[model samples]
Target chain A: MQFCVIGLGRFGQALAVALANKGHEVLAIDRDEQRVQEIEDRVSQTFILDSTNEKAMKSLGLSEFDWVIIAMSSDLEASILTTMIVKDAGAKRVCAKAATDLHAKILKKLGIDKVVFPEHEMGVRLAEILSSPSIFQFLELAEDYSIAEISSPREFWDKTIRETDARKRYGINIIAIKRKEPYTDEKTGNIDYREELIMAPEPSQKILQGDILVVLGHNKNISKLEKATR
Target chain B: MKQEEIEHLLEEAKFYILNNRFEEAEKYLEKLLKEHPQNIEALFYMGLLNELLNRLTEAREYYEKVIELSPNHEGALEHLSRLQGK
Candidate 1:
């Protein structure tokens, strides 16, 4: 995949480097020469040019990349203008970072393929994690539904899926189980651990102590299930 | 079943659903629908049950049936819209 990241701020730099590390061709652009120099070795290409310059942007053939991310939320005018230039150049996909609700509205009105509010999303994720102690991870699918990895409740220990009756009792479906098993190293005479994942575990499969359950359900029901841990 | 018996069965299903005994609710709803196939309440509850169980296709089918039987059914309309991502 080819990705172009504009405005080499902290977020853009991180995104570009990560994409490049993932074996994608990443082109990073910024007005600051230092920023370009900082990441020149990390990405496929680095350019120091004002993104608001339509001619310079068009010369790069923005449409050639699979995705172009405009990461300059701090400078609203430059961000908006760059987005327009990128869109006008027929970029296949455009994602922009929005600093505020009004900025997001404008980005949406401009027909941006995707708009992200990094700070707001991060805050919401942190809040969800803080409130759910039993939840190891959570991915919100909709306003009310989510998929979560939660510690197996005490009541569920040693019980088979049929016996636990999770779907009936909590209105949640356990999709997978993650467990860590101890093993002795044959040559070193030392104990080690290996992680195992059981996908779509059978109804007769038992929930063991220290097992993590990957479940999907409504948020309210998930909270109810989490409370069962106490 | 008699009217009183049907009402009692519906109440039982509703009770089970509210208490998070979805399997028991499904059993009772199945029994009710077996006798009264076109019961709107039974179909709607079945749809809700299937949705909670992650049987998306079955849920959509049940909700569609409910809408077909009664186009102005508000509950069915709302759930169907959500299921269809409308």
Candidate 2:
């Protein structure tokens, strides 16, 4: 896959580098020479040109890229103009970052394929982490639905999935279980841990004390389950 | 069962629940409820057992029953209020 990221802010730079690390071709563009130089070695290509310049943007032939990302939320004019130029260039897909609600609405109005608020999402993630320390990871699928990884509550330490009755009781599904098993390294005479992931754990499988349960359910039910940990 | 025997059963259930032996607690509570359906202590303990097991709906129902029987029951009222707030 090929991706074109306009703007060299933290979010855009990270996205470009990550995509490149995943073996995708990434073209990182920014008007600042230093910003472009910092990431030039990490991505497939880097260019220092004002993205608002339609001629320069069109000259890159962005239409051939798999996706174009407008990541200049601080400069709304530049972000919007870049999005328009990318769309006019007939890019396959376009995703833009919005600094505020109104910016998001305008991006949507512009028919952007996707609009994201990285700062807002980070704030939400931080709040959830602080409120539910037992939750190792959480992904909100929708307003009322989420998938979370939480440590098994004490009451469920030795209980099998069937006994716990998680689905019927809390209206949540335990989709996976992650456990760490310790083994003595014969050669080194030291203990090492191996991670085991159980996908679609069976009803008879017992939940161990240190197991991490990956659950999917409504947000309210997930919160109820989290409260059970206390 | 005699009043003393009913009290004994509720005590045993409470003990099991405190020790996190929810299955045993549930058994005792179930037995007490069968013989003394209106026993406030038995109903409250059953509600606590359900709450521990994250069977919130069932816990709420049990708590509601206790409140129905004894309007001024502190434990039942508190537990039900907390569950409802969730």
Candidate 3:
């Protein structure tokens, strides 16, 4: 896949890096010379140019890219103008970042194919983290499914893996366990493990309170576990 | 004037308010008010928090304060009128 990412801010940088790491060709552009220099090696192409200028963007021939993502989170004008130019340049798909509902509506009216709200996404993730302190981490897989890392709760403390019917009762499958280790060598000259953790723990292992459990399941089941832990 | 800090807190409060986290939003706005006691935006938002929480007395007090501090605060006057059964 070929991707053109406008604005080299945090969201844009992350998207460009991830796509490029996944072997997709990514063209990253920003007006800031320093930011473009920072990602020069990571992406297939990095350019410094004002995206709001239609002629400047046209010079790059953005229409050749398979996906064009406008990631200016702060500058609504730049985001809107870039989206319009990308679409007018004949890009098949254009996704724009919107800071608010009004911006999303305007982008939609201007023919943007998709509107992304990073703040809303972060808010939802923060709410989930706040609701489940025992969860090491969580990701929204889809509308119904989720992937989460839940540490063994107090109620499940000292319980063997076989004792709890998490798979049947909660409808969650434990994919792996993350176990912690100290930094020091117990038998020889001191060499610390430095509180590092390991993943894909044995299935039959008893989960301790601190042991992080990686689970994949539906959102309802994930919420059930969260409520139970709470 | 530390306008940047004020704006940051206002943004945080707005986010919490939009998510229906009234208590958190109130905390943020209260801190912001302590820093800028005469801030019309903070006063107006404090009144909004009180109204959403159904604390009519506190809401009225904050709304009245906003009007007193800045008579031209359009939102505060509108909110105050709505709260006064007018």
Candidate 4:
């Protein structure tokens, strides 16, 4: 993957360096010569150029970049202009960090859909981790829907799918179940737990204690189920 | 094994694969195949398990077996393309 990041503010620099470290080709750019120089060794290339300048923008030939991120935190005009320049020059995907709601609205009006406020996403994820039980791993699919690996509900223990009839009662589907089995590592010769998955079990399949149910449905239904199990 | 029994085995194998429990997953899958040599679902999963464990050649063979049983298996075809670096 090819990534072009304009602005070497903390957020942009971290994003660019992380991408480069992941083995993706990154071209880090900033108007400040010192910022550009500091990142030259970490990324594939670093350049000092005024992104809004027509000749400089043209020289980037943005089509070569698969993803362009405008992370100009302090400078709104520069951030917005660089976003416009990159999109106009045909960068496949453009993401920009918005400092405020009005700035985000302007980016959307300019047809950039991948506008992000990093702190907001981090906050949501942190809340999710803090609230959910250690057993369940949740992935938010949308505002209302999510997929979670939750420990089997207490009421479900020793019950068959036919008896539980979860689909009708909970409005969620148990897509799979994970169970831990004792085993020895092939290389280490030490005892360890090996988890196994059961996909789409039959209606007659029984729910056992300590089983992790991979459930997919609306977030409300999942929360209800989690409360009942707890 | 009954259909329900086979399902339980596949489920266990898939769980192991998800948790990076390859050896245990392989044990269940191998036992599954030994009992029901022509189970296409189990065959497909073995391929997936191998793919995740970075056993490319073994994964390819397992996927090919699934294709042999069910020629139009979309998962197998897609995985084969990835294995061959298409």
Candidate with best TM-score: 2
Give candidate 3's chain B TM-score.
0.91
- Residue B50 local lDDT, model 3: 63
Give candidates' CA RMSD values in order. Answer: 19.3, 12.9, 17.9, 14.6
Off by over 4 Å in 3: A17-24, A33-42, A105-114, A154-163, A181-184, A188-209, A218-220, B1-86
Name the candidate that leads on lDDT.
1
Residue A209 miss distance in model 4 (angstroms):
2.3
The regions of model 2 sitting more than 4 angstroms off are: A182-194, B1-86
Rate residue A51 of model 1 by lDDT: 96
Identify the CAPRI category of the predicted complex in candidate 4.
Answer: incorrect
Cα miss at A13, model 3 (Å)? 3.6
Clashing pairs in 2: none
Give fnat for candidates 1, 2 and onward, in order: 0.00, 0.00, 0.00, 0.00
Clashes per prediction? 0, 0, 4, 6
Q: What tens-digit string does per-residue lDDT give for candidate 1 at A125-179? A: 6677667656767887776898888878878977999999999999999999987
Q: What is the lDDT of residue A197 in candidate 2?
A: 97
Better of 2 and 3 by DockQ: 2
Interface RMSD of 1: 17.2
Superior candidate under TM-score, 1 versus 3 = 1
Angstrom error at residue A67, model 4: 2.5
Model 1, residue B32: C-alpha shift (Å): 57
Give the TM-score (vs. native) of candidate 2. Answer: 0.69
TM-score of each: 0.66, 0.69, 0.57, 0.58
- Cα deviation in Å at residue A3, candidate 2? 0.7
Considering lDDT, which of the candidate structures 2 and 3 is the better prediction for this target?
A: 2
Docking class of 3: incorrect
